[model samples]
Target: MIAAAPASGPLWQQVLVALAVFAAALHVLHDRAPGLLRRLRLGLARRLLAGRAPLARLLGRWVAPPPPAGSGQTACGACQKAGCAPRPADHMRNTP
Candidate 1:
């Protein structure tokens, strides 16, 4: 988790710090770049699952499924360029 960099400090500095942290998190979320929102949900659930607090783990249990296995391309090419994440099948009828 991001430690608030002196949220009590000057407002402009706080805003800049917040934005930078947000951008960094966004980059981490999107670096794979193919399935953006799917990745985000997966990532958040994983984080919540691994969190120290019991409340977080409880929330995770409500949201996430068992982790995906062999999710990457096998060259058997399960779903074309899309990684075989469980999410894609639920929305197969809709466009991203």
Candidate 2:
């Protein structure tokens, strides 16, 4: 029986593994604490893109808040119209 040698990957593989771990950690953070992540992104964008209105507008588009629950309309200024109308509740009553 041949013995298997210990596995040692190349430097690039090690770097890739580290990057994957970092990305996974970021994904978890974003999922678990989306509000915190959004605030951080907005703050960074504001700081980096200050005094640049066009760039700020682009960043604002990315960091805009999500639509209200069940509203089916985005809070972003792109939509000028209101959201969908609320459905009326069924009014049928039990009949003899």
TM-score of every prediction relative to native: 0.30, 0.44
**Cα lDDT of all candidates, in order?**
0.72, 0.69
Model 2 root mean square deviation, Cα atoms: 10.8
RMSD of each: 13.7, 10.8
lDDT of 1 by residue, 9-89 (tens): 888988999999999877886675637656667788899999899999989777664445766655455665544454546
Worst 10 residues of 2 by lDDT: 82-91
Off by over 4 Å in 1: 1-34, 65-96
The TM-score of candidate 1 is: 0.30
lDDT string, candidate 2, 1-96, tens digits: 999877588879989999999999889989999878777776766665664688777776666555446764544543545443323343355457
| Model 2: lDDT of residue 77 | 44
Q: What is the lDDT of candidate 2?
A: 0.69
